[model samples]
Structure formats: C-alpha cells, structure tokens
Target: MDKFTTLTAVAAPLPMINVDTDMIIPKQFLKTVERTGLAKGLFFELRETPDGKPVPDFFMNQPQYKGAQILVAGDNFGCGSSREHAPWALLDYGIRCVISTSYADIFYNNCFQNGILPITLPKAEVDKLMDAAKRGHNARISVDLEKQEVTGPDGGVIKFEIDAHKKHCLLNGLDNIGLTLEKKSKIDSFESKQHGTQPWLYAQAGR
Candidate 1:
C-alpha cells in the first residue's frame, strides 16, 4: 500500500447514490485478482454502451474527468457486497480519495486498507465539493490527511474526522502485514525463545 499523506488533483463528480461494488467493477471483471487491469473495468457499465463504446455523458468517460484523482460522490457510496476489489479498482483508476455524505461500512474500511482515503462529510460540505468537481479539471481539490482537511477549488476548507489508528497506518503506508512487520525483531526473539523452550514441538513439526 502507498502512503496517503496529501493529494491535490482533479475531482470527478459522481452524484448518483447507492453505488454498489458490482457497478464499480462489475461481476465479469472480478475473476482477476490483479489490481492494475481493473482500472479499465471501473464503472464499466456506466462508462461503456452495449457495443462497448465509451459513453460520452458519463463523468469518468468525459475528457476532463478521465484522469481524476479524487471523487466527490453522493450518499451510500460503495454499498452492497464487501468486495475488496472495489477499492482496488478505484485506486488503480487513480482515485486517491472519495468524498461522500455517507459510505457503506465495509467499503469504507476497505478503502483505508487499500490506501484510498474515504471521507465522510456532511451533505452540505459534500455538495460544495460536488459543485467544485463539476467545474472539471480546473477545480482541483486538495486532501491533506495529516491535517484532516479537504480544500475545494475556491479555497474553502472542510475538516473531517478519522480514526487515529487508521490515520497512522495510512500516513506510514502500513497495511496489516506491514503493521505486523513493525514488530519483526520482537517476533523473531519470541520464536527463538519458544524454539529453545519447546524443542520437542519443533521436532514433531519436522515429521
């Protein structure tokens, strides 16, 4: 996972509510575990037509938002199945942050794990960001995790609250495995002590 300290980039406005995992990457694109190729499948149905042509009206399909690094979305974003692929797709598509009025619990948690910042702000604040996003590439948004603040195009700032532990992990680029690795020396010492205390246990495992 990458460190998410601060990000300043174009934000794509996705005003639709109740966006689920299937709508994000679709079931057809779920077979592959690799994250890189999933960007093409992000919002696959909304981005493509029946013939697989890009939809001109879709926010992400539009030229201005094609490289958006942040998303200002409606309420209940990332609802439905608890698929880790959803965040993977979003991250792979260059969305470092998602600002919404609300988000599903599992998806919100998944975002933090995947180095994506899922921000929950009041409706009024989100609406402001959405409006800013509508201005296209000119309206770049700034997300500063250390300060827990999001600054919109017009220089208005919105403060958000986040779990301290999750904040710490993201700042240091520490996932679950990375967190465990932080105690490598301790773990190695404990294993050495256990090996000496229970030589029979190690011998039994050798069989």
Candidate 2:
C-alpha cells in the first residue's frame, strides 16, 4: 500500500448508481489474482464493444479521462459482491480516490486496504464535484486526507469525516500486514519465550 496524503488530479465523472464490483472488472477478467493487468479490464463491458473495440462515449475511454486519478461517481458505488479485485482494478487504473454520496461497506474498506481513498459526501456536494468533473481534464480535483477536504477546480472546498485510525493507516501506508509488523518485536519476544517453555513441542512440529 502507498501513503495517501494529498492528491491533485483530473477526476472522471461516472454518474450511474449501483455500480457493482462485477461491472468494474467483470467476471471474465477475474481469473488472475495479479493486480497489474486488471486495469485493462476495468469497466470492461462499458469500455469495450462486442468486437473488443474501445467505446468512444465512455467516460474512461475518452481521451481527457483516460489518465484520471480521481472518480466522482453516483450513489451506491461499488455495490454487490465483496470482491477485493474491484479496488485492485481501480488502483491499477490510476484511480487514487473515489468521491460519491455513498458506497458499499465492504468496497469502502477495500479501498483503504488497497491505498485508494473512498470519500462519502452529501449528495449536493457530490453533485457539485460530479459537474466539475464533467469539464474533463481541465477541472482537476484536490483531495487532502490530512485535512479531510476535497477542493474543486473553482477553489470551493467540501469537508468530509473519516475514522481517525483509518486516516492514520493511510497517511503512513499501513495495511493489515503493515499494522501487524508494527508489533514485530513483541511477537518475536513472545515466540522466543514460548519456544524456551515448550522445546519438545517445537521439535515435534519440525518433524
């Protein structure tokens, strides 16, 4: 996971509600566990035609939004199955942040684990951002995690709230494994003590 402090980049507008995980990466692309190439499969159905050609009208397929790092989407974003690959695909496609009125619980948490910031704002605020994102690459959005603010192209700012612990983890780039590693010394000491107390058990396990 990468540290997420402040990001200022182009935001792609996706105004559809109930955008599920399957719609994100699709079932056909779920064969691989590797996160690297999933970007090609991101929004697979919407981005490609029956012949596998890029759909010209799609927001992500458009030239201006091809490299967008932020997404301003409609309500119920990332709904349906709890697939971790959804966030992986988004991150791989360079989407560092997603701003929506609401999100599915599992997908929201998955974003944090994968270093993507999932922001929930009021519908009005999200609508404002979505409209700004419609301006294409010209309207860049700024997301500052430390300040919990999303600034629009015209300099308007909307404040948001996030869990303090999640904020800390993202700021320092700590995932679940990273959090566990923080207590490495304590775990090592406990294991050493246990080994001394149960030498016979360790020998049997080794066999």
Candidate 3:
C-alpha cells in the first residue's frame, strides 16, 4: 500500500447512482487473485459494448478523463456484494480516491483497507465537485490527508472526517502486514523464549 498524504489530479464525474461491484469489474474478472491487470476490466460493461466494441460514451472512456485519478460520483456508489477486487481494479486504474454522496458500508471499509480514500460528503458539496469535474483535464483537486481537506482547482476547500486508526494507517502506508511488522522485535523475542523453553521441539526438527 502507498501513503496517501496528498493528491491533486483530474477527477472523473460518474453521476449514476447505485454503481455496484458487478458493474465495477464484473463477476468474470474475479477469477484471479492477483491485483495487477485488473485495471483493464474496471467498468468493463460500461466501457465496452455487447459485441466487445468500445462504448465511447462512458465517463471513463472520454478523452478528458483518460488519466483521472479521482472519481466524483452520485449516491449509493459501490453497492452490491462485498468484492475486494473492485477496489483493486480502481487502484490499479490509478484511482486513489472516490467522492460520493453515499457508499455501501462494505465498499467504504474496503476502500480504507486498499489505501483508496472513499469520501462521503453531503449532496450539495458533491454536486459542486461533480460540476467542476465536467471541465475535463482542468478537474484538478487536491486532497490533503493530514488536513482532512479537499481543495478544488479554483481554491475552494471542503473538510471531511476519517477514523483515527484508519487515518494513522493510511498516513504511514501501513497495511495489515505492515502493521504486524511494526511489532517484529516483540514477536522475535517471544519466539526466542518459546524456542528456549521447548528445546526438545527444536532439537527434534533439527535432527
């Protein structure tokens, strides 16, 4: 996972509500456990036609949003079954953050775990940003994690709240494994003591 201290990038507007996990990466793309290569499958159905042709109508398919790293979407974003792959796909596609009026609980939690900031703001503020996103490459907005503030291209600012623990983890680029590694010395000491007390087990294995 990467540290998310601050980000300023183009935000793609996805004004559709109830954008589910299936619509994100599709069920067929869930076969692989690897996180890489899933970006191509992100918004698979929306970006492609029934015959596998590019739709050219989806927000992501537009030239202006080609390299967008942030998404401003409508309410009920990321709804449906819990699928971690959806976040993986988004992250792989370079989306480090998503802003919406509302999000599914599971998806919201999943975003934090994957280092993707899913912000839930009031409808009015989201609509403001969504409007700014319509400006194409000029949709640059700065998200400062330390300040818990989002700054638009025009210098407008909005504040958001984050869980203390999750905020700490994201700031330090600490995932579950990274967090456990923080106690490596203590774990190593405990293992050393166990080896000393259970010398027979070690000797048997070594023999």
Candidate 4:
C-alpha cells in the first residue's frame, strides 16, 4: 500500500450508477490472485467492443483522461458482488481515488484496503466536481487526505468525512499486513522465547 497524502491530478467522470464488480473487471479476469495486470481488464465491457478493440466513446478511452488518477462518478458506484478486484483494477489503472455521492459498503471498504480512496460526497458537491472533471486534463482536482478536503479546479473546496482509523492507515501506507509488521520486533522476540521454552513445537517428528 502507498501513502496517500495529497493528490492533484486529472479526474475522469463516470456518470452511471450501480457499477458492479463484474463491470469493473469482468468475471473472465478474476482468476489471477495477483493484483497487477488487472488494469488491462478494467471496465472491459465498457472500454472494448465485441472484437476486443478499444471503444472511442468511453471516458477512459478519451485522450484527455488516458492517465486520470481520480474518478468522479455517480452514486451507488461499485454495487453488486463483493469482488475486491474492482479496487485492484482501478488502482492498477492509476486511479488513486474515487468520488461519488455514495458507494456500496463492501466496495468502499475494499478501496481502503487496496490503497484506493473511496470518497462519498453530497450530490451538490459531486455535481460541481464532476463539471470540473469534464474540463479535460487542464482541470485538475486536489484531494488532501490529511485535511479531508477536495479542492476543485476553480478554487472551490468540498469537505468530506472519512473514518479516523482509515485515514491513519492510509496516511502511513499501512495495510493489514503492514499493520502486523509494525509489531514485528515484539513478534520475533515472542517466537524466539517461545521456541526456546517449547522446542518440541518447532520439531517435526515425521521429518
């Protein structure tokens, strides 16, 4: 996981709601446990045609949003089956944050774990940001995780709420594994002492 402090980048606007996991990465691309390379399959159906050619009409397909790091989308985004790959795909595609009026609980939680910030803002604020995103690469939005505020292209600011704990974890780039590693010294000491006292546990009689 990467530390998310402040991001100033182009935002892609996705106005459709109920964007499920399948639509995000599709079922065909779910076999890999590896988080990398899933970006190729991100928004598969929406980005490609029946012959597998990239569609020109898609927002992500447009040249301006080719490297967008932020996404401004409609409400109820990331609904349906709880595949964590959705966030993985977005992250792989360089999307560090997603802002919508609302999001599915499972997907929202998954974003935090996968180093993606899923922001829920009011519709009025979202509309304002969405319009800014439509201004192509020239319009960049800044998301300050520490300040919990999104600064729009035209100098407008929108405050957002995030779980205090989640903010702490993201600020430190601490995932579940990273959190565990924070206590590595203590764990190592415990195991060393435990093995010395209970040597039988480390021995494999069969081996």
Model 4: per-residue Cα lDDT over 1-207, one tens digit each: 899999999999887888888999899999999999999899999989999888887887899997899999988999999999999999999999999999889999999898888889999999988888888987699999999999999898889999999999999999889999999999999988978898887788421
| TM-score per candidate | 0.96, 0.96, 0.93, 0.93
Candidate 3 per-residue lDDT, tens place, 1-207, comes to 898899999999888999999999999999999999999899999989999988876777789888899999999999999999999999999999999989999998889889999887899999999999989998898999999999987899999988889999889888888899999999999878989898787786883
Candidate 3, which segments miss by more than 4 Å at Cα? 198-207
Candidate 1 lDDT for residue 59: 91
| Cα distance off (Å), candidate 1, residue 115 | 0.5
Q: Which ranges of candidate 2 are over 4 A from the true structure?
A: none
User: For residues 1-207, could you state the per-residue lDDT of candidate 1 as single tens digits?
Assistant: 899999999999998999999899799988987878898889999989999898888897789887899999999999999999999999999999999999999999999989999999999999988988999988799999999999989998899999999999999999899999999999999888989997787896882
**lDDT value for candidate 3?**
0.92
- CA shift at 159, candidate 2, in angstroms? 0.7
| lDDT of all predictions | 0.92, 0.93, 0.92, 0.91
Candidate 3 residue pairs in backbone clash:
none
As for candidate 2, its clashing pairs are: none
Ranking by TM-score: 1, 2, 3, 4
- Candidate rank order under lDDT: 2, 1, 3, 4
